[model samples]
Target: MIRFCSRTKLVANLIPPSISISLEQRHQSIATIAKMSDSKILIYLMRRDLRVADNPVLHSLIHNKDHGFTHLLPLYVFAAQQIEVSGFIPEDGGKSPYPEARSQIGSFWRCGPHRAKFLAQSVWDLKDGFEKIGSGLSIRVGMVDEVVKGLIESFEEPAGSKVSAVWMTSEEGVEEKREERSTKNICDKAGVDFKLWQDEKYFIDDRDLPFEDPKDLSDIYTTYRKSVEPLREAPRPALPKPEKNSLPPFPTDVPPQHSPFVIPTKYEEIEAALLKLINAQPLAKNPPKCPENALSVHPFTGGESHAQERLEHLITSGSITGYKSSRNGLMGTDFSTKLSAYLALGSITSRQIHASMSVFEDGSASDDRYKDLKGYGKGENEGTYAVRFELLWRDYMRLCTRKFGPQLFRLGGFKAEENAHLKWSRLDSPKDGFSKEQIQEIVERFLNGTTGMGFIDASQREIYHTGYTSNRARQNVASFLSKHLYIDWRVGAEWYECMLVDYDVSSNWGNWQYVAGVGNDPRGNDRIFNPVKQAFDYDPKAEYVLAWVDELRGVDELGQIFQAWTINDEERKEELGIADTDMVKNPLKRIDFKVNRGRGGGVGGGRGGGRGRPPYRPHSGDRWTGRRPSSQDQGRGGWYGGRGDRGYQTRGYQGRGYRGRGDRGREMRTGMMDKERDATADNE
Candidate 1:
């Protein structure tokens, strides 16, 4: 990785811009001169770093005068290995035969509909950004190495100048590294330069770390944060967006027939092509739509423009000031900064967000108009600090991926030798205690949200429908699968890779290992989260559960809703209107185990529960039941009445426990209008 200071000096020495002419004017002159000669094309192979702003490669190319490249070709390739189906599936029995990317372990679509749509939207937005600055993005679908090789060959004609070089941002994934090596070999065979710019996705550059090597970095998050927090350059300032016409002109001299692949430039044509690719996957819907109920929780569009808007709103509205307290919130748009999806796809850089927060903290921002906000002028408070802390955690995961290499994706993870004693059920190994069919059933039940644990089920349903879930919910669900169910952690990780629109390979797999007692958790096996306790703690009124789980929506009491199995068949029929036969048909496959006596409890009751450890159970008495509001207080419009449930009224749905919507409820409904307006807008 290149240091920022060194990169700056290199650019200055190479370009040495004149005071008379602006960088854009110089680029225009160079572009005009190039049109008179044979075109020397430089290919920018864009991957995760999708945005044109704060892009090191683009910045370097635009500033440098004597780089020898006359035209810049921005190319994005949808890798075949990531998009094509791995194995065969029957076309008959109402099944589609089109290719889809399936996971090796769970057979889940590697790039599911939600992520596909998000990626497509991001690519289109990037194209727009480029066009606005006098360039265009060329997109193709194929093996990356083959695609690059084809482009090099196409430009080798007598009419075209020699292909100068191929540049791309470096990534740390095992597969990504492999692709890089293969592309380098292709470039070498053709005597072309292959350059990899250091990845600028993280808040802190790797070279600024206190440790010499990433492997020497601390495994614990707290230790790592403490070491780096004191550094003045922990989060460097963001690079400016390239000026208009600063980029070399797009290669317009080459005819369409000269290219190996068809390039669709129109928005409609691009959207249609992306839709075809996405729907080719099994179980994919016609352009995946977010569930009506999930609109409030995940009202997001994938782009740099939307990302900036969200960051601005969070800062200006003083929502980020209360982020530490409200971040664990199960529902609502402003509960947390929904920038993960944008960050994952590189719609916006982490440095941009960090810089914005810094500006807000210093009270220097023009839009920092809210004076009543806590920590408005404070250098670092709990809220702003917590956001930075999370960003550091993201950096740590990526660094761990680099340090651990292939072990990051292995079954036993980095500490494979120490985790040898642990036994997990694998689909391929019947000796591991579960048959292939049994393991399939377990995975399917969990994925489909029919496991009967209301907290886990609700969270599962949310991710399935909207491609999103809060961090609090994600931890609980991951723990439920890995620590509670004793399934292979890789299976859950791969499933998450398929479902989450914000999926990052390092974070997703690294977190799974941490939760499964095989990675960088100092607590190890003690990191288990009891679903029942988590439900009452994070979602006290059962509002989140009632929103997603349809079967539990009929139950009014918080305890009955969270623990539906506890309600008898007679009560189910009398109150919930659920028949015993219907219950039998869709049986509650609840896992039962002994409750903990105290801190150091009983043993040997369930799978993986060793000595001094009992299976998970809810606490006794009122703690589990929760506080229920009385019917007389309905007119007061508290938790159980009025606007609480009326938020869902716009969608023609209402919880059984809440009162009917009224005129007053409609006026109070504006509070919930944060998401309503954005939800109706077409983000894609």
Candidate 2:
């Protein structure tokens, strides 16, 4: 197979203030490229996604071997261009001023010293990965296309090889579109073969598509499944180690920067000054590492290696098996997959995830493997299609961006339209430019979660402090804040976008619509959260509330769980207008996995639907729905409390145990979050 990589030698060491090569300058300078070899090479640059296995473009390149090709390279270029201009600031700027939603920008790929160190570490590890295979990188600078073109010119002719083809896949905005097109156009004019792959993430892949087009597809989810049932998926192919002797040489310098030194150095000096100032003046002993919070955790490495470590930990320890049952407890890491943060960066790919699930499911039917097949419907379905669906959902968001173009990000909130009228956040108080009292009220509680509403207050505090909240808690808190408290959901969603480690841009926006009454199932009315009821049902023992909100700890894990909803009789009249006699008691629920260990029992869930619906508008059927029975609907609901006990209150749960890792009453055995990343969670 033909191979190509960026020429590190071509990268300039220049920093910003120098003008980047213009398209004309690039064309003029790369004119020598037209004379290169008989066949051409197209090397797709990889960003955070560095794994070879399950790479579709790589598969296509391998498949094209018989077609007289010299090399198929997945090239990665290093230059200032990769730097997020908006993310970096001069020393005098006093550290990054980005809002929380955009905080990842600061440390993404290691923003400054910490990020630079992490990138150096990851790149160093990558160098090892390449060395193992005998291939080095072609690091280059300047315009991406210019550097790429220069390499094509320089490598082809002397090697008696023609650079006849190119292939690539991308996830980006307007500028990326132009670059891809320009490169393709140049290759075409040069008589080179060029191909661009389409990404079909979201609901399903194209081959598995229920119909030929979006309009022809099933209107409902059920119909969509039935139509695609005939076409089953084979386990996606895995990549073998690359042939080392075939690797290209490692380049040293990258392109020079050209943007007015990017940021002023003075800002850096100011930030250092501020760090010292803040630390000295703050009443608290330790000032925040970040002006806001600790953004640099060892838990913050971005790359495939880290992804693997997390996956290994989850599966080997059987955490995946318990994901369903305890995901909602809100107590600690054991309650959720901390994959999202790494996922937010392009560090890991979805296919890498699917293949790992395969390893976990392998076994003969006669062994314990047969038992693992319980909830799988004994159908021998390879993996939990539910997890697959969510992964695909991530793809769908990526797909939406490409398919819809800039319009996808242009609209505001759930409704594919502007929504400036809603009072968004307290920070947007009279200062930055908001005057509405309703807006101010939400801003008040959200800034620090001191709201008297314990459940809401508890969740807001946890996320603000540690950047975490269970899916159940997130939905419930969001619903109460927007629907019940009369605040706009957009503000809350933005806050999450800033704080969530696993935050996927599309999913975050998509989920907000699902909960805030916009997007797909946009509900026109309110879907208020009943804090008291929600606390009792999800955190039933209220251990989660106690754990996050210290004052609430030791008071009562269960007895007064519905405290916000008049946990006692007196408050019902004040909060929900229920009579003292109307305060119905709900019992605590727990898993007895020994009795229902295998077969089909496990887990809870999240997201989706169009605009205008109540926040957290869950699908109609399935466990984990947790729909509290209204007076009229109470009689018809099924018993969720457990077998023979009828007062369960319709908490739609599929059922299973929490992966044992972070269980409180059990042994604590987790390695630190940072160390776990290096071994990486999504492993080979």
Candidate 3:
């Protein structure tokens, strides 16, 4: 496990004594370097685009030999503000002085432990890739603009080589765009060229899009999907990895101490430096590790090699054929592609995934290497198409971010004018008649997974500990928080930003807005998910819920385990092994579906009378009915109902079914499920 230290210790350990001098002192030190190169250097600013293979910016730099650049300086800056203390810091035993990011609404570390560690791993892998091709990566910790300016100044005539240009992959986020503008301004002042290369992270490039202007793209996903589906087979191919001779020699004239920054080359040194930066933050009490008992189905290691290996395994193992059916699965690694993290970090590109799928579908992969594989030439199938469909969705989200701009992070989202009437609780201030204390209580319970809802609690716990959860779980939890708990949607979105290992700015914020009824949802505010029905539909056997929420494991009866609040005090203490002092006695009091049957009420309500539909009413056969299974209902999927005698019908179950048993109940339980449920049940 990773260990954390005080902020003072963090700062002390961050900078090497040799390079810890002031700007003026650093310039003097650089001037002492005996050797100088006349060759112009081009600084390639590495950001989210972490890989060397298929990287458009790197490809352009290497291929365009006559571009007037003889040497490449691949630089990656760990923005200090992102890693510094922010929000509430338990390690400090008080609030942090640093404010939240301009794009953020909450007070949480912008880069949590998992994200920091993953990023470090990616940087290390990228450095290794460069070294293999007779190159090196220069790393620093500072503001991007400041760092770039310093490097440009350090390379001035008398000191070393002149920096011809600074190139970086274009990003869609408001903050990233702001950083680009700032850097460009600096470059302009220095008379150095600044270029924003079109990012090749998507399946289709912007030039190939049917829309002449990206803003012309539709707000609806289906409309965008139809517009781009024709180009599905035409996604840009992955550029071949650059060879040592094909690329310009990496600049190594200036000694490490004399350079503007201290560049650590070894993986151990890189990771150690990164950990000190991350652990120095007040929120980082301990290095993040997926608990030993965590139900995580796969151990995620960051790198281009790992991403490629996983993609190949998914195809060769015959798993791609069943992806469409198993994508919604809540547990295990093979349920989905599990490549989002890699894609988000740009360790792997969407074009590469598409290209691999195409090879398998066209039966062109039946070569000697694939002869022993199980699903080498399975040909086109629903599963392969489904993967492509989801990839398009990812592209759509990014496009939406570009189109919406800062509005994507706003409370009203893209259609703010239309959503003016919608009110939500705020963490910083009271809203929707909810006091700050009241709002904090709700948000804290949701974050800690003590909401008394089984499915939501289980999902929250999974993300809180493991920094990951299924897409299905994400939707359900987002709805439960924004639609049901009435908390501000940004809180949930920002929290996910801090917690998710596969955090993509566009997808995370766009999906949150969609679920919060503030963005481009054709259903408007009417799209609500009844957690009980969702659990029944996705995790019928309660295997997923039981896997994370240990307290419910003691309840032998499957039905009562899901609806433990309905289990009486006597049964709860004796049979269920729950204590009387537990908060699971009754569900958290929030949106009561029993009374609120109007707009945004009940299970899945609507925005207005015309479109406002009643909440989803499961068919009688599908309903739990809060009664034990009878001979007729037995074996017909009617076994998981609440006790009818308690008068806790389906309405109550639907309203609060996502809550866990209790925090105490979760902590006291220490047993794992004795047996695994049929994997097929995950598809239910």
The lDDT values for all models are 0.65, 0.42, 0.65
- Model 1 residue-pair collision total: 0
Which tens-of-lDDT digit does each residue in 232-277 have in candidate 3? 4759888988877567778876324222335465667656655554
TM-score of each: 0.77, 0.57, 0.77
* Better lDDT candidate (2, 3): 3
> What are the per-residue Cα lDDT tens digits for candidate 2 across 447-561?
3554445566666666555556666667666655544443445455545654554555456655564444444332223333345445534554455565554543433324333
Compared with the true structure, the alpha-carbon lDDT of candidate 3 equals 0.65
User: Residue 526 in candidate 1 has what lDDT?
Assistant: 54
TM-score of 1: 0.77
TM-score of 2: 0.57
Q: Which runs in model 1 stand beyond 4 Å of their true positions? A: 1-37, 84-99, 231-233, 254-263, 277-296, 366-374, 417-422, 430-433, 569-684
In candidate 2, residue 324 scores what lDDT? 48
lDDT of 1 by residue, 55-169 (tens): 8888888778889888999998876566542211122323323344566666666777677777778888888889899999887766688889888887775334557899988
Residue pairs whose backbone atoms clash in candidate 3: 452-659, 452-660, 453-658, 453-659, 453-660, 454-658, 454-659
